[model samples]
Target: MYKEPIFLKPVFKDRIWGGTKLREEFGYDIPTETTGECWGISAHSHGPSEVINGPLKGKTLDQVWDKHRELFADQEGEDFPLLVKILDAKTDLSVQVHPDDSYAREVEGEAFGKTECWYVINCEPGAELVYGHHANSKLQFEQMVAENRWDELLRKVSIKPGDFVYVPNGTIHAIGAGTMILETQQSSDVTYRVYDYDRRDDAGNPRELHIEKSIEVAMIPHVDADFEPVLSGNEDLRMKKLVRENYFTVYHWNLAGSVSKIENPAYLLVSVLDGEGELKVEGETSSSFKKGDHFILPSTIKNFAMNGNARFIVSHPTI
Candidate 1:
């Protein structure tokens, strides 16, 4: 009977490399200039998003997932399987890597790992990011780290807006300065930092580096994820399948006008990137959204239609 979209209030996080672009670009009432992240659609304990509409108003996404499982089609998982975030990197983030599901559960005692994909929202000219490493073996990787041969060991790639990059578990990566992106990933927050550019904290203490764990999990001779983004639809509404993997399936929805009715078999995590739109659920005038808005379409509401000009990043956990 829950027919409306579940809008969630974003929970912002402060970081050393953060900036105010999140507010400037998205019109968010950010808490600080150093706000680096907006956890848009999340259920993780660290920063769960709260429901902003309907009967679930004021409840955190985790509560709705736990108490009202049918909203997500009774998805099988102890924790919500995915998280959606928007990041503003005013400066380079720490070069880091994340563990896979097995390592996360066995060592961190967590339900999931952090395999994520990024859709570049905007970036500065000549923007480049650490994507992987040049090391061909663990011995070489350890030696490079030991010798501080950063320039020789790290692999960098140029990026631009509208580009999609997939960072699988164990992939060493970093988000460079003056860049903004939307990230979708497993609902985990365990990051093993390898390098921090010799940066110090506000207290004048050097940031800690998880060298050992990073070395243990780092993929020797980094492998790139190979996949093609399939584009579909027409001038009115162009739907691009950005990714379809074991964990989740993501799409970039570009709407210039009205779109025909669509059915949702499972719940959907949606983030409006730009422009404005109205969503009609089962022909019910339920919700309207704009740029920077994030919400969920519960499984109970099977059909919906869209009207207006806007772009959205949409995803659903692969069940």
Candidate 2:
């Protein structure tokens, strides 16, 4: 059983639509000027995070999941259920859609789908995203695509800092340019691109578009769900419940001084988004943390206290 917090090293990915905001904001040693994503907490094959501290140090999260079941409260699963990422969109991302769990299992042989939520960290003035589509039916979606009527078929929404957007699977969406967001989602990498702005890669080849797959999975008649965050806390800490869905529950924690509580979930995934703090697993060990730090509080450490002024995006997988 693990008795300490497991800090993970993020894996960065360079994308065509990426930019230097990751370095400018988080102080990450980005691999390229176009570094787009920091896979902060992940166990997917595409980008598994490695434990940077504790006894599990140097072990990839995938290895720990496969070898040490006790660390995750003995949760039985073939793979980790959640992924956390920070995306910097210097240019618009491809308009895309993802399949549901049933579709993913049957068609892609994957264990999870891609229902995701984005916490808008920061964005330039007037930044907008493709939130959903206007197509009333699959046939109409196809017809619009065939006619290249993007203006009439896509629905765009303006966003700003601290805004939360829940994106369910089958929602046709895209991240617009000059936006940065912290994303929490089911651990899946399946994306079906519907549009790419006719942009070509370095090889001078236009990126692939999965028109059939996108139409097969996109929700007919997009409907945005109403998510009003519930707020509660004391003088020292304020908690905003972002969303509680089938796959995971996410929250934003703002700390002014200190707070103590019992760790109740199977495991807690935490990303320090602002300020600095120290976490003490009561009677065990304590560590200092600051912005851009990511760690998992395993089930083994039940009671803990955190002190300092900071903000964190905390989440846990749902059974």
Candidate 3:
């Protein structure tokens, strides 16, 4: 049997902190207050995911996890490598931090640490994000979290479209309201959420906060970014490298015409950003996709081709 790619329709995650209706793809429920993000594809461990396309098409992401176990965090000693998600922020997210590989190994007994990057897809007026902190120690951060002095302790940065922010493991961060962010990260969803503005969940209960773990794992002494991906071209088809590391190499490929001969890579994740196109992979029937469509291509695809003009973000492991 020839294996085709997998297209995942992400399950909706309603939060006290989301805003995106997640239009175009998932028919996710919207809230009355409208202060939450529409998370597509990958989400926290709180909920499972909906697989919407490709070979693993129409299957839950967790079903795949139970069967293969090598495509996610590999907690059972498999080789699953990364996690990717789209964030639609209608309100500010809680301040939080993630553990690094060493910390995760020693403290949490996890397979890998969390490191991620965000690419701004949409930004409303005055939109911003919390990238890191100004503090030099855990004590100062704890005090800030306690006193609700986020503005003082956090390094708030204004954002616009075409901006990219890298959040390495242990970096204190949060996504602000009115911004849509595409996040690519290590497969594990072990986040240490520190603060949540006293918001309650749908059950009207205060959500959990991992303050002690957050403080212990949060990065201090901010690392300034002197690096940005070079814009490669500006044709009907455009390719911009978002981030390249051992974990993954992501590229923004825009198109209006047919793109041919892409069949080999360890794995490829195609997220349609705009327009529409028909894709032929693994000798199966071609599939049509438009804005917000996505598929996970296996390493065995041969003679793959795309018909029509459509823009998509592609991600694959660097190895």
TM-score of each: 0.99, 0.98, 0.82
Winning model by lDDT: 1
State residue 264's C-alpha deviation in candidate 1, in Å. 1.2
Select the stronger candidate by TM-score from 1 and 3.
1
> Across residues 73-159, which tens digit of lDDT does each residue of candidate 2 receive?
888889999999999999999999999999999999999889999999999999999999898888898999999999999999999
Ranking by TM-score: 1, 2, 3
lDDT for each residue of candidate 1 in 1-319, tens digit (9 for 90 to 100): 8999999999999999999999899999999999999999999999999998889999999999999999999887789999999999999999999999999999999899889999999999999889999999999999999999999999999999999998999999999999999999999999999999999999999999999999888888999998889999888889999988889899999999998687796999999999997999998755889999999999998899998999999999887
Residue 88 displacement in candidate 3 (angstroms): 2.2
lDDT of 3: 0.70
Superposed model 1: Cα runs more than 4 Å off: none
| lDDT: the better of candidates 2 and 3 | 2
